[model samples]
Every structure is written in C-alpha cells, then in structure tokens.
Target: MSLLTTKEIMEIIPHRQPMLLIDTIEELEPGKRGVGKKCVSYNEPYFAGHFPGEPVMPGVLTIEALAQVGAVVILSCPQFKGKTAYFAAINNARFKQKILPGDVVMLEVEMIKQKGPIGIGKATATVDGKVAVSAELTFAIG
Candidate 1:
C-alpha cells in the first residue's frame, strides 16, 4: 500500500497531470526523506517524439520525477506547507540504464543538508531493484 496516493500527493505539492511524474509515495519522513513510484506508460506524451520506434523515458524527466519526490519530502514539513520547492541545482547526476515503458520506477530522496529555504537531497531512481539514475538535488523552498 502507498503512504500517499496521487490525489493526496497533489494536496501537498502543486504538480498536476503530465508534469506530475510520481504516481504514489511509498514511504515518507516529512522533511527528511521520501520514496515514490512512477508507472511508466507507452501513452506518455513524451514517447511520441522521444523515440518513435523504441521509446525510452528521458533522463531529465527521470531526474524531475526524483526531484518531485524530494519536493514532497520538503513540502510536507509543517514549516514549509503550501510552498513550492524549486530546483536550485542538480549535481553529479548519473544515468546507468534505459527506463522503458511498462517499467515501474522506484524513486528515493533523502534530505542530506538544509539551511533556511535551501536544501539538498540525495536522490536515486531504480527499476527492478537496479539503479537507473542517481544525483544530488538542491532545492529552494519558496
């Protein structure tokens, strides 16, 4: 069972359809960490042009999905409620494998440092227990 459904997640963050990448949050620790899930589909708009013959989820979008999970982590904090978490920076991002349709991505983000409105999270996205992407994501809550 999911800790936060898509509807519940929408209540905490401002992301909407198409742009809202995470389908559910499996684990949460308010401002400290979160584990989210995204069910990749062939019908996704990006697949139309990302690659016609063989579609693959873009690395940037995967990063965005992970960041959205991070957003949930920070935005769920009582002090930061009703605020948006913007990407201040993304560092040391590494993409290890292709994320294809019909795969379910497990996104995880752990807030490692924070000061005032700025924070950084260690993020990773995996499929079938294999790492697909990993990065250090910096966010600014506003």
Candidate 2:
C-alpha cells in the first residue's frame, strides 16, 4: 500500500520528464533500502542519438537511473523527507550488459552507511535477471 508511484516519486525528487528515471518504487525501508522500476520505451528522447540505428542504453544513464532510485531511498528516510540528496561519489561502477529500449529495469538500492551529512549506498540494475549495471554511491544530504 505504500508503493511510490511516478507522481509520488516526483514529489520526493527534483527530476522531471526526460530526466526522471524512475517509474515506480515497489518497496521503501526508511534509512535502510529500496526497490524501484523503470520501463524504458522507444519514445525516450535520447534513444535516437544513443545509437544511429541500434540504440543502446548509455552506461552513465543506467547508473543515473540507479542513483535516482537511491535518491528516493535516501529521501524516504524519516529524517530526510522534504530535503534533497546530492551525489557525493559512485565507486566500483560496472556495466555488465547492454540495456535496450522496452526493457524494464529493476533497480535495487541498499543503504550501507549514514554518517553526519553523508550516506553510502549500493545500487544495481537488472533486466531479465541479468545485471546491467551496479555501483556503490555516496551522497551528501542537507
């Protein structure tokens, strides 16, 4: 019942159309972790230039999508609701597979550490049971 729809995600994060990477949040554990979904479509504006004919999801955008999911998780923390979380770092980023249009990526994020004003987290994106991207991210939240 607490699932976050696109509208709710919009309220929690500043990202919008074309940049808004998350389509839904199926689970949220304040100060702990989260699970989100993004269904890529052929109509995405970036698809055209990402490839001339054989469009492939960019590694950076895939990581960004994962980060956006992490952002939602950070904001869901009871103490941080209504605030913004900024990216501080993303380590060990890896793109193991190519993500194409029409793939529904399942993004999962887990909070690993929260100290002072910074947070450390890990995120991974999977499509069809295969990992497309993964990274450890750190954020400085105000």
Candidate 3:
C-alpha cells in the first residue's frame, strides 16, 4: 500500500494530471524526507515526439518528479499547508541513464538544509537499483 496516494498528494501540492509525475509516495517525513514512485508508461504523452522510434523519458521531467517529491516533504508541514514549493534552483544535476517506458522510477529526496522559507534537498531517482538521475534541489515555500 502507498503511504500517500495521488489524491492525497494533490491536497498538499498544486500539481495535477499530465504534470503530477509521482504515482505514490511510499515513505515520507513531513519536512525532512520523502520517497516517491513513478511508473513510466508507453502511453505517456512525451513518448510521441521525445523520439520517433526510440522513446525516452525526458531528463528534465525526471528532475521535476524529484522536485515534486521534495515538495511533498516541505509542503506537508503545518506551517507550509496550502502553500506551494517553488523550484529556486537545481545544482549538480547528473543524468546517469536513460529512463524508458515500463520502468519504475524510485524517487528519494532528503532535506539537507533550510533557512526561513528557502531549503535544499538532495534527490535521487533510480531504476532497478541503478541511478537514473540525481541532483541538489533548492526550493522556496510560499
């Protein structure tokens, strides 16, 4: 069972369908950490033109998914309730492998630093234990 479903996540964050990349949040620590999951599908809209014959999930989307999970961590706080977590910056992002359809992306993000409304999180997305992408994400809670 999921710790938080898509409906529950929507209550915390503003993301909706076509943009809500995470299907389930398997684990979470209100304001410190979160582990989410995204099951990539062949029917994803991006697969149409991301490549004609070869469909690959966009790297930027992968980063966005990570950020969304991070948002859940921050936005779940009572102080941050009804707030939106905006991407302040992305640092040291590395795409290690191509994420394809039928792959399940395991998303993990840990809040490492925070000051006032700004914070940073170390995020990683993996598939079958292999790192697909990782980055240091900065966010501002509004």
Candidate 4:
C-alpha cells in the first residue's frame, strides 16, 4: 500500500519521468520525515548507457531520490506548499552496495535540523534490508 502514488507524488513535487526516481511514498509526516520506494527496472534509460552487460544504478541518482523524498516532506508543509527544495549540501555520503535492476529500493529521510528556509536531513536507501547508500543532506526551500 502507498500513502502517495507516483501521480500524487508528482502533485506535491516538481519532478517528471526519468528524473522522478521514487515510485511511491510508503510513509509520510508532512514536513518532518518520509519513506519512499523505487522499483528499479532494466528498461530505465540510464541502464542503456550505464553498462551493456553489467548495469548498476548510479549512486548520485540514489542520493537524488532520497533528496526528492526530503523535498516531498518539506513541500507537504502548508506553509511551503507549491515551493521547491534545492540541494544546498550533501555530506558524508556512503554507498555500500550496488543497486541492480529489479531491486526495490526503500528510501528514508528524517529531518534532523531546520531553521527558516534551510533544513538538513539524515537519508538512507536500502535494498532487502541492506543499506545501499546513506548521507546527510541540506536543502533550501524557495
């Protein structure tokens, strides 16, 4: 079950196909935190050029997916509705596992600190309960 479907998610965040990495919002807390999911497919455009026989999801895109979840969290707030969240910084990112096609990635982001238009969150992406990537992300709401 999903709290927000891809269409619903698009209504909240300004992302389109190819760039909209998350497939669903599994859990949400408005401006505080959220859990998202991505169902990786071999047909993904990047998989074409990323590799021929051995394809791997890009680490930066994983981070971006996490950031989009964070953006959904922030933009869901009544005060910030219809706004955009831009990356300010990404710190201490670690990619531990290769995310392959057909894997379902669980994206989680928890707001750790925020003041005015700037905020920071602790983000992590996992596949089958194994960590694939983790980072601290900072963003500015504008």
Candidate 5:
C-alpha cells in the first residue's frame, strides 16, 4: 500500500489534475525525503501533440513530478504547514532515457540542505532499475 495517496497528497501540496503528476507517495519523511510513483498513460493530453505516432512523457513533466514529491517532503512538516514550495532553480538536470506510456516512473527526492525558506534537494527519476533523469532542485517556501 502507499504511504500517502493522491487524495492525501492534494491536502499537502497545492496541485490539481494534469499538473499533479505524482500518483502515490510510497515513503515520506517531513522536511527530509520522499519517494513517489507516476504511471504514464497513453491517453495523457501531452501525448496528443508531444508526438502523434511516438508519444513520450516530456522531460520537464518528469522533473515536475520529482519536484511535487519534494513539495510533499517540505509541506508535510508541521513547521511548514500551509506553505507552498516554489521552484526557485533546477541545476545539473540530465535526462538519460525516454519515459513512454505505461511505464511507472519511480520518483525520489532527498533534502540536502535547508535554511529558513530556501532549500535544495537531490532528485531522481527512474524506470525499471535504470535512471531516467536526475537533478538538483532549489525551492523557496512561501
């Protein structure tokens, strides 16, 4: 079972359908780390134009999914309750492989540093034991 479902995640983060890419959080530690999953679907709207014949999950969306998980880690903390974590920067982003429909992407983010509302996290997206994307994300809570 999931540690947090999409419904519960909705309460923690201010994201709605289409924009809310994280499907379930398997593990979470407030202000520390989070592991989540997103199952890509062929019917996704982006697929309609991303490529008609060969649809692929956009790299930016994958990164957004990672950030959403990171938001969960940040917003779940009692001290940060009701706050929104805005994407301040994305560094060292690398997309290794294409994510296709029907693939379940494993999203993980670990808080590396934090001071007040500014923080950074090491994030990664993987599929079937292989790394698909990795990045360092910076956020400012508001």
Candidate 6:
C-alpha cells in the first residue's frame, strides 16, 4: 500500500548496492502486486567490460530483478510476518530486448497463488512500455 525506495527495500530484502537492482518501488499492495524500478547507469562496473563501447544490461540480471521484486510482494504480505522468501523456480521466462545504460526499467509482479510456505507470481520487466522480459516464478517462505 505504499512506495519504497532502495533504502526501504533493503530493510526487507537484505540486498545492497551493486547487487541491488531495484532503485525504487513505485507501487506495493502487500501480497497482491508491486512495481519496482532500476536505473541503469553508464558508469556501472559491468558496463566497463560488458563490451567495451556497447553496454547492454545482462538479460539474467533483469530476471533477477523481477524475481526480487516478486519476493518483495510476497514478503511484504502481512501474513508473512517473520518469514523469508527464497526463489525456488522460474518458468516460461523470456527476454525480448536489449536494455542499455541510462534506461530506467520498470519491474512489475503479481502474486498468482500462495499455499502454505510456497507462493507463485507472474513478473514482467518493461522499458518505455515495451516488454523486455517476463516469467512465472515460485518462492518459499519459512
């Protein structure tokens, strides 16, 4: 029910700079859904060696960001108090575009199901309205 910046997200997820892909979460509905953002930078360490002059965000990183966002949605649920969410699986994941430095990609995730210690979610990454990646991810909370 509120927006969270990386600082707030860090409090919940235990991720930090360099490894923390999400810069801010613009939307949050506890367990139902959430939207997060990642601002790619030209000075990122990866860009220095990602291709010399062409710096494309790694595709796997996008998926990780989405999964982390999805984890936030699940972990933030009131019912999940004192629990930790860990990704267990990923399905039907696809990447369609090249994400570059200076781009602000949006990550959105929707909870599909929650059963006991396991939860499922659908996630998508977009840049300027174009779908860059998507997947169905499952997580476990205990």
Residue range with the least summed lDDT across 10 consecutive positions in model 5: 74-83
Per-model CA lDDT versus the true structure: 0.97, 0.88, 0.97, 0.96, 0.96, 0.86
Off by over 4 Å in 2: none
Q: Across residues 77-110, which tens digit of lDDT does each residue of candidate 4 receive?
A: 9999989999999999999999999999999999
Give the per-residue lDDT of model 1 (tens digit) for 19-58. Answer: 9999999999988999999999999999999999999999
Model 5, residue 130: displacement in angstroms? Answer: 0.5
* Reference-based lDDT, residue 72, model 1: 97
Per-candidate TM-score against the hidden true structure? 0.99, 0.95, 0.99, 0.99, 0.99, 0.92
Write one digit per residue (lDDT tens) for candidate 5, span 121-142: 9999999989999999998999
> Model 4, residue 63: what's the lDDT?
99
- Give candidate 3's error at residue 25 in angstroms: 0.3
Compared with the true structure, model 2 gives a TM-score of 0.95
lDDT of 2 by residue, 1-142 (tens): 4399999999998999988988999888877899899898998888889998988888898888888888898887778888888889989999899999999999999999989779898889999989989899998886
After superposing candidate 3, which stretches have Cα over 4 Å from the reference? Answer: none
RMSD of each: 0.5, 1.3, 0.5, 0.5, 0.5, 1.8
Model 5: residues with Cα > 4 Å off, grouped in runs: none
> What is the per-residue lDDT of model 3 for residues 40-67, given as tens digits with 9 covering 90 to 100?
9999999999987999999999999999
Poorest lDDT segment (10 consecutive residues) of candidate 2: 73-82
**Which residues of candidate 1, in runs, are more than 4 Å off?**
none
For residues 1-142, write the lDDT of model 6, one tens digit per residue.
3489778898788677687889889998988899999889897777887778889988888988997898788888777765678889989999999899988899999999888879899999999999999999899886
Sort order, lDDT high to low: 1, 3, 4, 5, 2, 6
TM-score result, candidate 1? 0.99
